[model samples]
Target: MAEGILRPLGSSDLRLSPLGLGCWQFSKGRGLVGKFWPVLEDSVIRDIVRTSWEGGINWFDTAEAYGGGQSEEMLADALSALGEAGRGAHVATKWWPIMRTAGNIGKTIDERLRRLKGWPIDLYQVHQPYSFSSAASEMHAMAKLVQQGRIKHVGVSNFTADKMAEADKALREHGLRLVSNQVKYSLLDRRIERNGIMEAAKELGVAIIAYSPLEQGILSGKFHSNPELVKQISGPRKWSSGFKPEALNRTRPLIDRLNELADKYGASPSQVSLNWLIHAHGETVFAIPGASKPHHAQENVNAMRFTLSQEEIGELAELADRSKR
Candidate 1:
């Protein structure tokens, strides 16, 4: 297991490897969001999962919105292929709340379980805060699932600080707690720090699962070195500000610092960035970097095999701070 220390996903009993595989790329090109990545063969997905498992990752994060449960199915199949299915590989998924009510938490759970091949949802989350009802209502529904043994933990994604507290309070009413909050956090986008999300998670004992910890490969420094590479990639990231010239120019210094640290540790820039993130807030922050290929999965697990000193972490943080100026 590479001596990778397992961290808690909040106060819950769930102990996860510092990094988990984000299954968005395994969506099978089935949904509006799934179109972001090309459909992969079953063998390819299995290989990625296999690499991650051998590298020490113990969990995965997928969503119902990702290919409308296709991601969940693919992930389960991959785990099963490796005999790592069942409770051995902890899996987390989110419920799509847009144009839906909290009632769907229970309403659609059967399909979710069926799609997952009955492997159990270790942590089931509400996908967003913009649902038809309040966060409290969503928590209540999630709590019911927990009580019914449908899910092991409750979490929320893309929620504001106040909204997270609201969900936590609702869970508390049932003698439960909101274990985690998944959000877009990375060296390139540290909005959670300025926006109170990280602080709130800490205060409430909620773990922050950082999705896009690589910032869609921006932190890899490849796109910055060769803008032409952007044309070959699919998805909205090519159109996002991070890939634009101005943003690239602004983030170059941070990327350079990542490379420097990478050389010192014999790691890739993505590894250094992922290392800094999981250690960014002690064990409070865990990251889910996606992988479309086996080597990408290998690089992600290699990220956990090393540690960044407080000085290097501080250096990267300072550079990121300056670049944002």
Candidate 2:
């Protein structure tokens, strides 16, 4: 497939690849919740980064909480090895807002920068909405960082519709706009669509950064064809109902539809799943699928190589809705 296409990121001046490389797996399951997967070799990490960059992925998403900050360091190292070419890549990292006040937002900026090896954070976000500080105060803090040139854009993850609006209002108080809201959205998880988050984002002209666009690989149809692959899964997903035999059997209709569409488009089921997200609500949605290997990275970028028709999209949406829990 050809290189990925770039689209405007909400109201920001910045542009991003429709599909971004998620770096959560780079933590190799080390920090807090990092043990979901086994640790990977340094060589393997570098190759994944290189493959993602060469595959036309301009943005990478990571977090300070991931692998206890190891993920950020690994991402920085991988990009640093690319030298000048990597300079153009956009890095998005998040601040863990647990048991901390808004002041911590300012205090931790330098540390995040340090972990990223001084690379400018293109999009800095609050990993969650559990900070001791008010949403307004946190937005102001991030706005201040933007004004001070510590970060380029301010975003949040896992925020509700009202909370997201509040954050945008607070940023506007500082003459800034909330550019994106990172959330778990896929064919399997349509809560964002039912909840007010998706509508709020569109109403406010904010981008929806979709994490787990592949539904933790459940939508990839891998486990269905090879049930043995279920044992190879790590972390919470190993025991999640989505991977159970009955759930897999229940979701067969959706998987079969995805496979049928993939064959028609000459793409993989994973690619079809992701493409549906990119065109789901015009260009307001973007996906960040994790890539632990070079082939995974390449396959992710290929998702952008094709487009699904409105009829195909509607059919898939129906199938997904039926398969939802």
Candidate 3:
């Protein structure tokens, strides 16, 4: 572990390396307007997970909704492989909030645990706040898992500030507290800061897990000069409003500056992007950047070893602040 980089997930026993491996992309293909379809095969995913573990990514995240349970199976394979190699990695997964009824809460936990194949899941989260029917019952079920040692801690994802507080209050009734909130917080997406999500999490001592910390590779200088490549990678969603060419245009200056700084630091654009997040965001804040290639995985692991200067952090933040998207 790199000294001074590991940070505790507020109030939880779990300590995550600054850069975690986001396994969602291994199973879910990418697209510009939206994500691509037809998830990767089990063997391909297993290889991705193994590479991630070997690259010092001790923290891996997945969700039950990913590839309709295939993601969990893939995670299990990686966990088993890591255990065999004596790596003993940590895993975090999520439960879709649509299945929050009392009758299904306990069963859902059991099914997720079963798919994990006895590897202790460090964190289990509610994927979204789709519904809150029997919130008490659902929280209690999670509490029961902690008691049974099936899950180490509880968390929430894509939750609003208000919903996060409510969940925390309800879980506390059962003597459980949510340790983190996994939200999309990056230079390109600052909605959390404006919407009070950041403030609430800080006040409640919940760690913010920043997914898409590279802004879907936008911050890595890949799409800076090539609008056509951006469109090609965006797939059918290219026509979607979210995949507009204007967004790519907005990122050019930041991309150029990132490249310049990356050269100075002897790192890739991806590493600079991750380092920028760590410095501009809180020390408790951690990012999970997805990588489909082995070299990409290696670059991500190397990102944790460096520090961004205060001046560079501010310059990058200002550059992003000026970006429209």
**Candidate 2 versus the native: TM-score?**
0.97
RMSD of each: 1.3, 1.4, 3.1
Tens-place lDDT per residue, model 3, 234-308, is 445345443467766777788888889888989988898888876676675788887665677778887876788
Task: Order the candidate numbers by TM-score, best to worst.
Answer: 1, 2, 3
- CA lDDT, candidate 1, residue 43: 97
Q: Give stretches of model 1 more than 4 Å off.
A: 1-3, 84-87
Each candidate's clash count:
0, 3, 1
Q: What is the C-alpha lDDT of each candidate?
A: 0.91, 0.90, 0.75
Segments of candidate 2 deviating more than 4 angstroms: 1-3
lDDT of 2 by residue, 212-292 (tens): 899889999998899999998766778788898888988999999999988988889999999999997999999999987
- Please state the error at residue 159 of candidate 2 in Å: 0.1
* Comparing 2 and 3 on lDDT, the stronger one: 2
Off by over 4 Å in 3: 1-4, 28-44, 99-103, 132-137, 234-243
Task: For candidate 1, list the clashing residue pairs, or say none.
Answer: none
- Ten-residue region with minimum lDDT total, candidate 2: 1-10
